[model samples]
Target: MADFDEPLCGCLQDMFSCLIVFCVPCGGICIQAYSVDKATSSGMVCPFLWSCCLGCIGSAVNRGQIRQKYHIEGSFIMDCLISCFCGCCAATQEYREVMNRERPK
Candidate 1:
């Protein structure tokens, strides 16, 4: 009975751990998805509006560093989503710049 209880406890712990790892990322992605939809509907791809995404990504980076130093299961995954979205936006800006630079009069 004791051995069975230990395994059960371990499994429960693992489930909680996984949830903590994913929850922040899920939230961040939802926000970014909304941002995209809003941008498309408005017909304005405002790079300045993406500053919020940068903030979220910065938070994630900070959390990741905290986790590294303290070994805490902080919400660092949010950082990943933010970073990905920000990177995509930045790349798009660079592409636009290059295209404009090559445009003929």
Candidate 2:
């Protein structure tokens, strides 16, 4: 299985994502969720509410989804821990992974 496109600590490499995640984590998570699934983005209010109330759980789920989609090697427990302890970094790394992988060459 492949690993994450970028390391968790590599969050700093993408300054824009890092700044957004650091300053407005929920918004960053919303964007990441949207990028993964447009249908989810339509219900902006619901996601925003969830992000506010269950940010860690939401992020961990989202991280797992990303890992599944990209075939990245990781477990849900690790995702949970990363999302819980390094929320901003995890969000930033997720954002970068999606953007980097999905972007056209």
The numbered model that scores best in TM-score is 2
Error of 2 at 77 (Å): 0.9
**Worst 10-residue lDDT window, candidate 2:** 38-47
Against the true structure, what is each candidate's TM-score?
A: 0.23, 0.79
lDDT of 2 by residue, 36-95 (tens): 563233444554454567777777777777787788898988888987898777777877
Q: What are the Cα lDDT values of the candidates?
A: 0.36, 0.72
**Residue range 1-105, candidate 1, lDDT tens digits:** 011112212323434333432465543333333333332333223323443445555434432432343343435564456355553332232223223333488
lDDT of 2 at 39: 25
TM-score of 1: 0.23
